[model samples]
Target: MKKLFMPYRGAALQLKNHVVMAPMTRSRAIGNVPNELMAIYYKQRSGAGLIITEGTSPSPEGLGYPRIPGIFTDAQIEGWKGVTSSVHEGGSKIFLQLMHTGRIAHSSNLPEGHQVVGFSAVKAAGEIYTDNGMLEYSAPVALDEAGIARIIDDHVKAAENAIAAGFDGVELHGAHGYLLEQSLNPYVNNREDNYGGSIENRRRMAMEIVQKITASIGADKVGLRISPFLTSNDMPSYEEAAVHETYVQLAREVNRLGIAYLHISNNPGIPEKTHQDIREAFANTIIYCNGFTAETAEEKLQDGSADLVAFGRSFLANPDFMERIEKNSPLNELDYNTLYSPGEKGYTDYPELNYISSITS
Candidate 1:
């Protein structure tokens, strides 16, 4: 519909359309720094209304996956400058996703002095892919009061670094079993202190990070992604009632703080009414993401439930995804093998529809 193509003006983000390119980990940031190749990859897909980058660690301990980008070091910030500038030149707003992997990590992925850490001293179930191969996740050290402070400080610094790197804003990765979500999960956060126990206490770390980051970079420039039902990376699913109660409270509190947007990862079990409830709770923008087709996204927009729709695989495989949807052109198949492998083979090699047609003709 025409609504999906209409410009969306948020508190901090002004996009040319409502199609959002979801944050997806491509694992191409060689040596944990954003590079020119990453710039070219994002630049190629600048047709999206907004681009939320791949998961980028905020600190050394947050490095759970090999080759994932970071914003802590000066070199990382300088490296991201090229990415931000390229995307901007292509006429799209981009947000840097700040992700901390928590217990879902191996020591080899971390810096020499840094060890894996999380809300509790729990070890995640599955193995993580390292440079060597599949390595089992190690039990993380529980964060002390000082460690908690450091994590919050690192998040704020990462947000500042993203701004310095020319990003339009920063999106705190609070979902998909990352550090923030780990703290929110009742199964993972079994601590006896203020950060554990009731839903309010369990949700404290994420709340504090959002508040602190908003303090450092204004609430208008801060966004958060949440998945209350995600079971990946040892995240446990809470009961339906508990999930609604916990996340609705989170939505309300963050809405009071006036955040730019709340990015929701919608799954099967989570009801549509729940999305509507969160939409009502938040004041600014709500981006619903997860296996969405253009038709369904337009329907959601028409129903007034979501302001934007974020596509992950579609945008990844189709560099001109918006254009393809507009013209009803066929989409390219995703190569799962190269999704995490290094180099530009599948990273920046996905061709635009027009380019392919020109060559064929």
Candidate 2:
């Protein structure tokens, strides 16, 4: 059997195949809670060995996007239970990705009485979509020491909630200029305190969150996603050397903690040396995601570069993604429209190959 289709055995993860469904926010969670529609959507695409859920806020303050789900509330947890149960019934493990959007948000998206907060007061230079339409990024309230502590606690509680909701584990959204990434970027984090300044100081928040979460839940049930050198979400470019060192150090620290996996959001901008350095530093399952076809993903697995490969758009468009790959069938093109719009038109309406074949016959 091909490596991509082969079962994987690693730290607390046993799966049907090596393919992973990368987390992509679909904004279908009406009222900031998961529902039956979301459960059906995940169950349809449960061919992957593991499914990391879309960015779910760990707290009310972290709901930075319109219609994104949260796991911090009782109703949210109950809603996610249906989704997790459906995925498990299809024989796939699922992890809830805890994301705090931080400064990459507008106030209108957040719940009443909850304001945008981040490592620093600096505002990201981009507009985020809200019910009121495109609005400038909200100026973040720089987290004092107490605020930082509370955020960390929120992440720990969310992880616990995920397990209660029937998730196999939890993945921390430490990338894409979210709250965790905000602290890692020196340009955004201008504090002189211990949580900012030098590389160690800047990375303190992430380390603290990871350490606490791993302690709260076993290390083997936790994963983190990172996108180094990604300038998205209005993240300013910093010294390249510093960027390389920051992640390498983080990899080493997490490795010491014996976490489940490190998900690297593949970017063309990252140097080969950076990849090699991260591969060497972190001695566990490393998932490489973004723009990988099945052929290229197999090549990555065979070359020993990535233990598992994650697909975002492929799974988004094709519910039976594994069946299509095995049969060498053409994939359905993704509809750019309704990517985040409410309802099931472009979301769950994508046809499976079997359904298409029956219709054509």
Candidate 3:
């Protein structure tokens, strides 16, 4: 077998290669429903061995940004069926990344003006761009035991919906200061209950969600995305000992559950020893994203530091990214203004290999 095209295991995945398409939040869905164009966008790049979708909300109240898609409603499910069907036809496997915005949400984007919910009432220090405009985030309702149970049920339903929509599996988005990450981070979760006292408890919410989701789907169909010390748009890095230790515990506990893979950060120089140490705790496939070059990814793969490398910005600009990597071709520069806009003008309008004339030519 070719070295770069080698197959690998992700706790359960029998995949074609180690190159993964990272989960990107493209604000293109309509009413949290995937459109035909969206399906085409994904199908265009099915050359990657694995494709993890954009962050999809598990519930309406959990929506954090305008036009971000979901996996909850009937329309959304049907819409995603189109996406999965198209991607599969293109000969690629994909995992639906189930995400919850938590306190990162804005009332304007929610249907009933629901207040954002978190591990505590602490409002993350950031702004959320909603349909109305940019809004200052408010303190989230501290999830009581009942609320925690409710959230778990929601995740279960979301996972079921994802599978029903024909996705290979569901990956809990536990990174970038989202809902699951909020419950794990001490800086956001300032509670005294069993859900927040120590590192183990703080990580309890994530574990419970995982347990519920796996129960709804099978263990082989369950995976999780986590950024050890990644700060969000509003949350600064509190990547201290308390935070790092919590994740080490998270990896230890979640690993036994037999998740597909543990998605992590790519900034080795920044996270340094702490990050590498955390990666050592989990004996599963580690997928790393953010600023990864082909050569660097190869080194990590050969060194056994990461089993898979997820490409972010590179994939956006180069739809033929996987082929380009294999053939070492030049990449196209992405147009920034069209990134978040509606329609194919910027999203799917980019040309393929022979379509666009090189700007430098």
Off by over 4 Å in 3: 9-11, 269-272, 357-361
Pairwise lDDT winner, candidates 2 and 3? 2
- lDDT, candidate 3, 1-361, per-residue tens: 3445677756688777888889888889987689999998999878788899999988877877778898889999999999999989977789999888888877777666566787788887767776666779866788898988888888999999999999999889988888888888777778888888688888887898888777678888887887776666455566477666777788878778877788886544345666677677777778878888888888878887788888888888788887787777888788897776778876777677756546535
Better of 1 and 3 by TM-score: 1
- Write down the lDDT of every candidate, Cα atoms only: 0.90, 0.95, 0.81
Q: Write the residue-wise lDDT of candidate 2 on 7-86 in tens digits.
A: 99976689999999999999999999999999999999999999999999999999999999999999999999999999
TM-score of each: 0.97, 0.99, 0.93
Q: How far is candidate 3 from the true structure (C-alpha RMSD, Å)?
A: 2.3
| lDDT, candidate 1, 150-247, per-residue tens | 99999999999999999989999988888999888888999988899999998898999999999888998899999867787778777888888888
Q: Give the least accurate 10-residue stretch of model 2, judged by summed lDDT.
A: 124-133
TM-score of 1: 0.97
